[model samples]
Target: MFLYFLTLVLMVMGLYCLIAKKNIVKKIIGIVIMEYSINLFLILIGYKKDGIAPILLKNVSVEELTSRGVDPLPQALVLTSIVIGLGTLALMVAICLRIYEKYKTFDMSKINKLKG
Candidate 1:
C-alpha cells in the first residue's frame, strides 16, 4: 500500500545518503534512517484493523486472542532492533569523534591515512 511505498522511499533515501555523502556523520544518519524504515515496515506488517492488544486476559481464549489481536513477534523484534541500533549509533559516533580528533575534518577526501 501507500505506507509500504513510503517506507521504501525512506529506505532509498537512506541508501542514497550513504552512497552520496562523504561525511562520516551523514553516513551514520543514513544507516539510522534505514534502520528506522525497516522497523516501521515491520510494525506496519504486524498491524491489524480493529485489532486488540496482544496482552492476554482471563476471559480470552487462545483462539480468540489469536484471531482478535495483532501479532507481537514483529513488535518484539523491532524493539530489539531499536536497542541494537542505539548501540551501533553510539559506537559510530564515538568512532567519528576519534577520527575527527585525528584528522581535524569530517570530509572523506581530506583524510589520507588510508593511502598507505
Candidate 2:
C-alpha cells in the first residue's frame, strides 16, 4: 500500500511538472521523470517477495519453475519503454537546442511569436 501511494505521488508530480512548467528543458525533464515513474510501477507489478530468476533448465519441472520464477514480460516491456523514452528525450532536447539557437532565450513566453 505504501509503495502504491509513493508510485501515485511520483506519477502525479511528474505530470504536474509536465503540464505546469513552460520551459522546454523543464518539460523534457518532466517527461523523463514520468517515464521513469511508469517503468518503476511496471516493475513493481511483477515483483515477488521471494522471486528468483526465470530460467529453464533441462532438469527443471514446469510446476517448480512456475512457482519460483519472476515474470519476464514486464522486464521486456520496461526495456522497450526505456528505449522509446530515450529516443523521445533526445528529440526533445534537439528541438530545445534549435529553439534556443533561434530565440536566444529559454523562456517559453519570449519564444511565443506564433501566438496570434
Q: By lDDT, who's the top model here? A: 1
Q: Write model 1 residue lDDT over 35-56, tens digit each, in one string.
A: 9999999999999988888888
Candidate 2 error regions (>4 Å): 58-61
- The whole-model lDDT of each prediction reads 0.93, 0.87
Cα error, residue 4 of model 1, in Å, equals 1.2
For 1-116, candidate 2 gives per-residue lDDT tens digits of 78977888898888999889888798788888888999999998888778877898888787878998889899999999999999998899999999999999877878877755
| Stretches of model 1 off by over 4 angstroms after superposition | 58-64
Give the worst 10-residue stretch by lDDT in candidate 1. 107-116
**What TM-score, over all chains together, does every model reach?**
0.89, 0.89
